[model samples]
Target: MTTIRMVGFDADDTLWRSEDYFAAAQSTFESIVGAYVGDDARTTERLYAIEKANLAVFGYGVKGMALSMVEAAIEITESRISSSDLQRIVQMAKEMLRHPVDLLPGVREAVEQVAADYPVVLVTKGDLFHQEAKVRDSGLSHLFRRIEIVSEKDVPTYRRLLEEFAIPPEGFVMVGNSLRSDIAPVLELGGWGVHVPYHLTWEHERQADIPADAARRLRSLTHADELPGALRAIAAG
Candidate 1:
């Protein structure tokens, strides 16, 4: 097998704290909505339903979720929610957007180790502006040869990226947390994938369906500290 010529990294969760904040916001949203509904257990499910449906219209990110939350709050409460609560939902999103980018343990060392031997690209998704801002704030942007803030991380998107990098699927390994966005797509394209899980994940990303036959191309790690060694193993194969 060809050695890895380019390494693709996902920014959110893999490099820094992300989902947990969103989870916190979601909890707050539920509490806000709960004051009206009184422990309606399906509140989050309803919110997730709206978010899933709105994915195409709003795309992924805090802004999208904000819109969905507002919509869900209005619909879930039958428009009985107060304007103040609605504003609070909006404020939650702003807080998330302004949330500091906290890099995970050893993330910088891992990226630097890999970049020293291979061209590394940061392929991440979210609202373009927010994603760009987070990447800039993360202070690790200088290590990447290229930064791609994409709308989605699916098969076609990865295919296009590999083509732009002039590397074949067999010679690239995608590293990140989301099984659906980061690992599944790359594995589907005959590339190697490493899943370094975060403590929390969005419900949508948790639904990743990697091909059963691609098991040999997939690796899972508990932390970023294991990344360089995993890449070396993939290369040796």
Candidate 2:
């Protein structure tokens, strides 16, 4: 019988405070560049463009963001951006890397409870160093049987994870906030996806709309503590 033998988690916004830092950093970047570019909206748009363009090359993380910000600033300022201004951009990334990891509400309780029943693993994508650092700092690492910090999270990635762990897709459930990164890929692979929405979402991670069937799999929980019940429902299904 197919059952949830392994539960996979997306580490960023789903588990802790991640996008919040990126949002704050973007605001800082916009302010710095807007001073020279004269229009905050246009500057932000340009930075977004640069970031999207760099995603394939840099994958994702503060370092990529910092490089994109520098490139955007230089272009927006027409090469007039000062050395100090450039340093500020680098500092923004540094602060983000150094920022403390704060686990989201009920994360500890949910992970603890779920770990007691099912072997849970962290399947996250980002800069290896930063993601690993956050997992270590969050103090939730011990709850997971293993950790996967990949360059991207897609159908292939999910398939690979299942193969490595020797778990069938039907016997796995993925829990996360981003539909694009976390939920969609798993659903496409025939695995269950439980989406826990976060208030702040990065524009890049946003998807147009989840499919009707995929939407049905979602469990709208007020907090992570409700994850065990959701998993039980998925298992029973």
Candidate 3:
């Protein structure tokens, strides 16, 4: 019989509406840049372009995103911005850090159900401080038995985590929003994965398609509300 001993969940979009806050902050940054550049459309486009181009250089995280906003503001304003404008942009970035964490639909109920039967762990990748802060604020933190904030999610990361936890691949399940970071790597490590697609995934984490083999290895749910049922089915199988 296949028994699930540990269930690992991805943070961010998997459990909550994370990107919306970032999107709001980006819009605010673009507006600030627009005020200085004189052409709103052109300024917004240029700022977005700069943000896309800088992904490889800065990666993800609040500090990096804040820096990107600052750089974009400077670039779009042609380095002519007043001190007050620069300070507003910095203030907007700081406001993003204070955005209230809100869970996605069904996330809390799903976690509660799963926590009743199995040990749950949150496996997320981001800057340590930012990620830990979100986790602590989420109110769902107590449901998890362990938390991992990693720089990357790969086969090696999954393997080491499984070994450290004394969790066999067959007895573990990975539930997340990213096919690339959460599903594929865990599937490669011989664990099952449950994919709950998010409406807006960070561009870097997007995958071309779900591989057939990986798809076959997974049990998917359209919403977190369906998670408990999926887990029960996995157990029944």
Candidate 4:
């Protein structure tokens, strides 16, 4: 195995607080709409369905999520949802956009340590403006050599990233929370992938279990600070 010379980080849950906001927003949305239907479960399921359906049109972001909430509310109530409640859903989206960027535990120390030794890149996917805002506000912006806010995370995207950075896959390492978006692609490209499990993964980012052989190319850490040691072990192997 080649020594990894470049490290890539995933921005959302991997670096800072993200999904929790969505989860919170969902709760708020349900409370606002729950009065009409009185069934939080149905509304929740409907919201997820609307989000999935709108992904192609809205892509991924808080704005799209707001739209989905409105659509779900209208659908659940048969368009009987009040205009004021609709406005509340819009307000929820605004709140999410203005939400603070809270970095996960040890993100700063680990990122700084890796930046001192190798080039670090932030490879993240989502609405361009929101993702950029999170990175800019996260206070870890200066630690990365470059930032790539992509629409998708797949094999070709990683290949292009490797080429753009002028690094071979064998010499690159990706640390992220989602196996589907962050880990699997880099592993398929023959790079080292370090999985750091997150508590609340977005449904769309979930995938089947990785093959045994591929899973062996990676290590799982419970926290961000453990990343430096994991990378060192990979290099040592």
Candidate 5:
């Protein structure tokens, strides 16, 4: 019989504070862009549109968001935005990139506890340099058997990772904050999921649709402390 021999974790939000910073940067962005455009709602919408459209090109992380912000600012203001404000936008991204990694409460202990019984892998997607720095800074790197910094989290990616591990999809569990990225795809591939919802999520992540049957294989936990119990429950079933 197949069992949950390996567990995967998503880095942002799930393990640490991420989107909160992004939200703040967006507010900063809105303020910078707001000077030229009076409509806050329109400004935010336009920026998001640009960011989403640029995902394939810029990919994900502070640099991508920074570039998209610069583009959005220019387009929203019709090139009326001054160089000073543009510099401020660049400063915002700089602050984010340099920001320290603050892991969530109980996450370190939770990962340690889970790793005691099963092998764990970090399945995160973002800028390679940023993710590498975060993993090195996390202090929890030694707990993971493998660290996957992916471009995107989808069926194909997960399948490849599982193949590399030589484990079947049904014998794995993915723990994360985004249902779209962490939970749904793994569940679709017959893996179990433990969802630890963060207080803040990106607009793009919030829009992902999980399949109707995903809930049956998913365990939603509010805090990191509850992860081990959820995994035990899955293991028992």
Candidate 6:
């Protein structure tokens, strides 16, 4: 096995607890929508379906989520929500954005240790503005050698990063929380991947099937504190 030289990490769930805040906000938005649309199982199901469908079209971001909430509310209420209600939903979205950012357990120490020996890069996908804001606010920005805000993570993105860094796949590793976005693509490109699962992952990011190749390359971890030792083992292999 080759010594890993570059370590790429997914930002949202790997380094911090992000999605739960959004989930809470979503729940609040749903409740507001329920008031206008009539509280019931049918309305809840319809709103969830509409929100899920809109996610495919809008992608993940604060603004996209806000739009989805608005659209779902309109759809369920038959366009009858008052301007105040719409404003309230928008305010809720802003509040979600403003939720306190907390680092995942041991993430800071792990990154600090990893950066001492290898190039650490933050690779994440989302609205550029929102993602950048989080990155800047997290204060982990300085620890990374580079930051890539991608629209998606796939084989092409992984390959492109390897090429740009002039590094072989065997010399690179990706650390992230999402199996679909972070682990699978890195393994597909013959690199290594470490998965650090968060409490809440976006529904779309969940994977029903884990490819054998990905599974072979996968190292599931409970927290970022385990990363330094894990990377050492990978390098030794």
- The TM-score leader among the candidates is 1
What are the candidates' C-alpha RMSDs?
0.9, 1.5, 2.7, 1.4, 1.2, 1.9
Model 1 superposed RMSD (Cα): 0.9
Reference-based TM-score, model 5: 0.97
Candidate 4: regions farther than 4 A off: none
The TM-scores, one per candidate, come to 0.98, 0.95, 0.85, 0.95, 0.97, 0.92
Question: Which pairs of residues have clashing backbones in candidate 2?
Answer: none
Q: Give lDDT tens digits, candidate 4, residues 1-237.
A: 457889999988999989999989998988888888797448877889999999889878898898888889898888888999999999989988999899998999999998998899999988898888989999999999899988788899999989989999889999999999899988887888999988998888888467677777888999999988888889888
Residue 161, model 2: lDDT of 86
lDDT value for model 6: 0.83
lDDT (C-alpha) at residue 92 in model 3 = 72
Local accuracy of candidate 5 as per-residue lDDT tens digits, 183-218: 888998889888888998888887666677777888
Cα-based lDDT for every prediction: 0.93, 0.87, 0.83, 0.89, 0.91, 0.83
Q: Which tens-of-lDDT digit does each residue in 112-180 have in candidate 6? A: 999998999999988887888889988899999999998778889889989999989878899998988
Task: Show how many residue pairs clash in every candidate, following the order shown.
Answer: 0, 0, 0, 0, 0, 0
In model 3, pairs of residues that clash are: none
Instruction: Give one digit per residue, the lDDT tens place, for model 1 in 128-181.
Output: 999999999999999999999888999999999999889999998999999999
- Model 3 alpha-carbon drift over 4 Å, by segment: 36-59
Q: lDDT of candidate 1 vs native? A: 0.93
Quality of model 5 by C-alpha lDDT: 0.91
Q: Which residue pairs of candidate 5 clash?
A: none
What is the overall TM-score of model 2 with all chains considered together?
0.95
Which residue segments of model 5 deviate by more than 4 Å?
Answer: none
lDDT at residue 4 of model 4 (Cα atoms)? 82
The alpha-carbon lDDT assigned to residue 87 of candidate 5 equals 95
